[model samples]
Target: MTRTPQSARTTTRGIPRILAAGLIVVIAAIAAALGYQSQNASSSSAPSPPSPIAPRSERPGSLGAGGAVPDGVTVFDDGYPAVANLDPDLLRALRAAATDAADDGVKFYVNSGWRSPERQNQLLREAVSKYGSEEEAARWVATADTSPHVSGDAIDIGRSNATAWLSEHGAEYGLCQIYRNEPWHYELRTNAIDHDCPHMYADPTQDPRMRQ
Candidate 1:
């Protein structure tokens, strides 16, 4: 048998060592990849935390802010800020009138009542956009400072029958329409029970209160 050279033996031994080292490196890399994938899977499967509850003092607006009334909301619905936030005397008169209106087969639905200053500003902006000028917008939407709704002293009644009932008997409850142009708009005038309501303004623009 021929003897192998010393160099040949060294080369054959080195090849197996190199291949073993490469295999170990490949195994370590695969294991590391699998560990990372497992970690991500575990993280993805975990349940998320629950949402926080809104504070009790935080009230929702009909327009997603405070002091808006939804359709069909009545004076009796004190749950709404629109009804509950009204001036005490005004709310009292409204409830009294609403009770009598119900007896007459009419419901006292509140179209609009108390309004946040933000909501008033929003309405004013919308009015300006619709009528093409702030001068014209004043006829409909009042400034936040001048709007009785912002002060919870006025309410807009809904439905023709409810307004008709108010037209006929509202003075008994001291509820009076304030604007001739807006029959739905009512304000509490306690003196109206003794005397008829003060002369109606043609619109909000004509009201001296709007000037302030």
Candidate 2:
């Protein structure tokens, strides 16, 4: 048998060590890349923090015993005391008017109707604050004792279109706009159905009914 050369044997053995070292380097590089990718994915999937600004909550006692009239209440919504507690004659006239108004693509939304005395007083106070004095406030909000809303004899309609419709045709149903400045304000005046509405007061301050 021929003797093998030491240098050739040594070189053959070093080939496996070189390949093993390169394989180890490749495995280490792959592991590092996988780790980096996993970190990026974890951060991307994280949830966001809560919002800083919150919605305003309703104040205590903002709504009085009668409760406030909701935004979309119509004359026919008896579920609300604002509509149901109105004077019988006035409610009847409003319902009749609302029925007819619907045919013209109009809706009689009750912006304000019956209010408790407490609610009226609160409104008066708010008005006084807004207008800077009781005298000026009186032009807009009446005293709780004298306010027709407390007695369910008054209603404040809403949306310009509804008021326009009422201005043209309210007299037919005995629903007359009482104040020139407040075309939205209305009351039942049965005579209006025949003789047309009486002269409108400049504002609530000029109406004798507000004095009481």
Specify the highest-TM-score model's number: 1
Report the backbone clash tally of model 2.
0
- In order of appearance, the predictions have TM-scores of 0.70, 0.69
Candidate 1 residue runs with Cα over 4 Å from true position: 1-64
- Each prediction's Cα lDDT score? 0.89, 0.88
**Which stretches of candidate 2 lie above 4 Å from their native place?**
1-67
In terms of lDDT, the best-performing candidate is 1
- Model 1 clash pairs? 61-65
Query: Each prediction's Cα RMSD?
Result: 7.7, 6.4
Candidate 2 — worst ten consecutive residues by lDDT sum?
55-64
lDDT (Cα, tens digit) per residue for candidate 1, span 1-212: 99899999999999999999999999999999999999999999989988787776564433324677767788888778888889999999988888877888999998999999999999999999999999999888899999999999999999999999999899998999999989999999999999988899989999998998
